[model samples]
Target: MAIKPAEIKKLASLSRLVVDDKTITDVTDRLSSVLALVDQLQSAQTESIDVSRPFHIAQRLREDEITESNKIDELQATAPEIYNGFFAVPKMID
Candidate 1:
């Protein structure tokens, strides 16, 4: 799984990634090691591994109901200018 200089250039061109010669060498080594580990895992006996060993997840549906309502009097009190029951702001257009 050792990536060549030419292969790295090809991958960089396709992915639009900018990599120098030094960076290419480093990335090649890292990627080759990762691929080697993946190749080893692929050959392993994973069929006997239990799926529920990690954790079990369950989704709970909530009832659609208005639990609490907003107080309009408190909201209107904090307004700069209140005409009936609305906050006034400066006009955007000249």
Candidate 2:
């Protein structure tokens, strides 16, 4: 389907885009071509296609293991205040 200049103008207005008079025709042509391609894709036959198969191969992942040492004591050493293993902050709500 061909996109009209008026439709393009309305779309530009709705999208808050600044489309000038010169570019409106170019934008309309590009949009129309995209819509035509979409229309062509919609006419494709996919009734017999299998949906169970994955499109990509599975990636090899590294083994899950702890790589860093825990430093909670070292980190909390410089805090102004800590309570029950957590940083203490002033209450903001009444």
Candidate 3:
């Protein structure tokens, strides 16, 4: 399906794009080519293709374990203010 210049103008207006007269033909040709490629892709034969199998190989994962000890007190020691184990910031609104 080829895109018309009038449709391109409408799309440009709807998208708030500033497409001049010279570029309208170029834009129409590009959009028409893209639509033609989409049409070609839609006509592909894939009836026997299996959807259950994955295209990529399964990745190996490591066991989840705690590697570091909690250092909340050590980290919060540098904060300017702390309230009930949480950082306190100045109120910005009433």
Lowest lDDT block of 10, candidate 2 = 51-60
lDDT for model 1, on a 0 to 1 scale?
Answer: 0.80
lDDT of 1 by residue, 1-94 (tens): 6778788788889999977886888888888888887777677788988987476767678899988788888878877787767776778889
lDDT of 3 by residue, 1-94 (tens): 8889999999999999978998889999999999998888768798888878566777788889888799999999999999998999989899
**lDDT against the true structure, each candidate:** 0.80, 0.90, 0.90
Q: Which stretches of candidate 2 lie over 4 Å from their true place?
A: 45-94
TM-scores of all candidate predictions against the true structure: 0.42, 0.45, 0.44
List runs of model 1 lying over 4 Å from the truth.
44-94
How well does candidate 1 match the true structure in TM-score terms?
Answer: 0.42
Among all candidates shown, the one with the greatest TM-score:
2
Put the candidates in lDDT order, highest first: 3, 2, 1
Q: What TM-score does structure 3 among the candidates reach?
A: 0.44
Clashing pairs in model 1, backbone N/Cα/C closer than 3 A = none
> Candidate 3's error at 76, in angstroms?
30
Off by over 4 Å in 3: 44-94
- For every candidate in turn, the CA RMSD to the true structure comes to 12.0, 10.8, 10.3
